[model samples]
Target: MKPLDDQQQACRDWFEGLRTRICDEFEAIEREAGSGASFEFIPWERTDEDGTPGGGGVRGQMAGKIFEKVGVNVSTVGGRFSEEFAASIPGAEDDPSFFATGISLVAHMANPHVPAVHMNTRFLCTTKRWFGGGADLNPPIPYADDTADFHAAMRAACDAHDPEHYPRFSKWADDYFYIPHRKVHRGVGGIFYDHLDSEGEAWDANFAFTRDVGRAFLDIFPAIVRRRMAMPFTDADKARQLEWRGRYAEFNLVYDRGTLFGLKTGGNIDAILMSLPPVATWA
Candidate 1:
């Protein structure tokens, strides 16, 4: 898609910048957190139905001997939103017009104590483009302090741009991250919202908000890692971690609209599935 508007360009640039910052920050954090860690960025190309070139993304994987796995991925996909694609996702049945562009990202941490997190910040245009995406946590084992810390960091980020954002989106995260059958949350929630328009002053404010959250990830997650990474995990803890991972895979495969949308749109399979843990046991 042509970069026709300022907001679209800004969103693109922001994602580029975030990709760099996250990779660098994670490397440093991994070193401080423990040993036997390594990260590699995977490059991907986006193509049209006829194999015509479109766009691409960067996928990064960080694995440690101490921890199971960690991955962070960023992608920019633009083109027509097909009906077939819309039908794949749970709520995206409307099948908007032919023009869509945005960045989607997800981060999964290896340590069961650290929690897995996902975020997709994008500026998508149908009739007109709009911004969406937020960060949320999914912990295998609940730690109230860590949960509180994660939320507080997210709240602070939102508050920097708009004070009203924290409470509104916090509740949104809580509602979105819930698993009905289990009667439990995927994790202590952070924030989730979509369909933000770049009209009035809202666009500028939201851009700032998005940037704040993007930067906040580096600050919030590593601290949790430092606290939990070296802590001894028993066989039972490992078993539970794998069980929780199964739940994670279920949510992404069954419930997450983003995963469905990506897969249906012919997104990079490896990058899309980066949210899955490196090692998981169903039973």
Candidate 2:
């Protein structure tokens, strides 16, 4: 594995910082809910095919009064992609060597009334570099208000970058987050975009947009959580949430690109699977 350059290091640092901020905010919520729970950070290492040090990351997780299971992970890793997989990734067509740094979080609320959510943003470099990711809402008991607010936050983030972004990416999310076999949308869409390749002087521009996406999430999601976390839920609601979680598990295991990327790159198994809910039921 090659050493990360200045730009790569900057991305790594920013992702780690975001991870800390997210975990802190989540822990605060747990405290506010009168739970003493806090994030437990688990460190993991990664290595290249030759068994040389590649990179590693910490997975921060907590189960408490508010959040049933939440995972915020940040990793920076570099190595060559498998030949078969290399063909699918942009720029890796010619050379499979790559570097990636990112933060990924998924929260499954204890209260069925509270919506679960997923957010991730990553910077990857092969022969080229680009940024990708977005956030989406997953409410088993759908709430129009929460869906609108989540999309609104995402829209504001996109507008700051480019007016065209929201529409383009919202459609992308709708398209990407669907489960064809189940014939159901994963959740009310927010935004999902990729291959925002740095086209000469676009790195800073893209990075700024990515940062705003993270900030938008930080600003919006917790408020939504707090709003619904304390709402009363019955056994039926809990059952619905578990069934929805089953769909979530299917999507992650079968189709999530992040999961595939982590697995292919020799990522930490526990961290990669940390997105799975603590319990899920199929109906």
Candidate 3:
């Protein structure tokens, strides 16, 4: 595989910048709670099967009084996908080699009333190139107002580029973030989309949209966290949060494409599995 081109580097830089800002904001949140916690950064490298330099990434993680557990990571990697996985990825059917850059984040709140959230966006190139990712809310104890606010932010981000985005992507999230065996949704959906192929001007448009999605998340989620983080919680609420986290665990381990992709590409195991909650319970 060849080195990243100018456009690829631009995308990678944006993702890394987002990661830095997010980590800083999260650390501020911890400080406000009178907790001395802050993200511990760990750096790691990637190598292709033949031991060629593939890229690497930094993982930032923190467990604080209010935020419980959160991970924000940015990575740039390129190499040939495993033969079996190549058959499944778009554009990789003909050429298994691919380049990918993105930021991924998952936050699990200490207060059950405060929602757990996930957001990620990426630019990928194989025989073709595209952008894919979205954000969703997962509250153990559902609150109508919070759900509405989250959707509103996502909708505004979508509406900026194309009016059709919210409806299309929100429904896509409803379908994608589902647990088939349990016959239940993973959470209240925000937006989920993938394989947004970049054709001609589409690259610029899609890249702009992807950046807005990140901005929307950075804007709204902290507000939601602040609103609920100080609220009281009972034993029952904590129990529900644990049970809900089990479902989250199941979805990531069994169905998350990002997890599979990372593992297949020989990504850092700790960084890839950082999405899992710090603790969870089945019953």
Which wins on lDDT, candidate 1 or candidate 2? 2
lDDT of 2 by residue, 9-101 (tens): 888888888888888999988889899999998998898988888888888888898999999999988888889999999999989999999
Per-candidate local distance difference test: 0.72, 0.93, 0.95
Clashes of each: 1, 0, 0
After best superposition, candidate 3 residue 15: deviation in angstroms?
A: 0.2
Give the poorly placed runs of model 1, Cα more than 4 Å off. 1-5, 33-36, 84-110
lDDT of 3 at 83: 88
Which candidate do you rate higher for lDDT, 2 or 3? 3
- Using Cα atoms with residue i matched to residue i, what is each candidate's TM-score against the true structure? 0.87, 0.98, 0.98
Where's the lowest-lDDT run of ten residues in candidate 2? Answer: 1-10
Write one digit per residue (lDDT tens) for candidate 3, span 1-283: 3677988999999999999889889999899999999999999999999889999999999999988999999999999998899999989998899999999999999999999999999999988999999999999999999999999999999999999999999999999999998999999999988999897899999999999999999999999998898999899999999999999999999999999999999999999999999999986
Q: What does candidate 3 score on TM?
A: 0.98
lDDT of 3 at 235: 98
Off by over 4 Å in 2: none
Q: Write the per-residue lDDT of candidate 1 for residues 1-283, one digit (tens) a residue.
A: 4444666666777887877776676677667755546678888887866565656677777776434566667666666556666554333466444334454555555656667677677666555555777888778888999889988899899888778888888898888777777777787789887776667687787778778888887788777767887777778877788898887777777777677767766788988787776666676
- For model 2, the local distance difference test gives 0.93
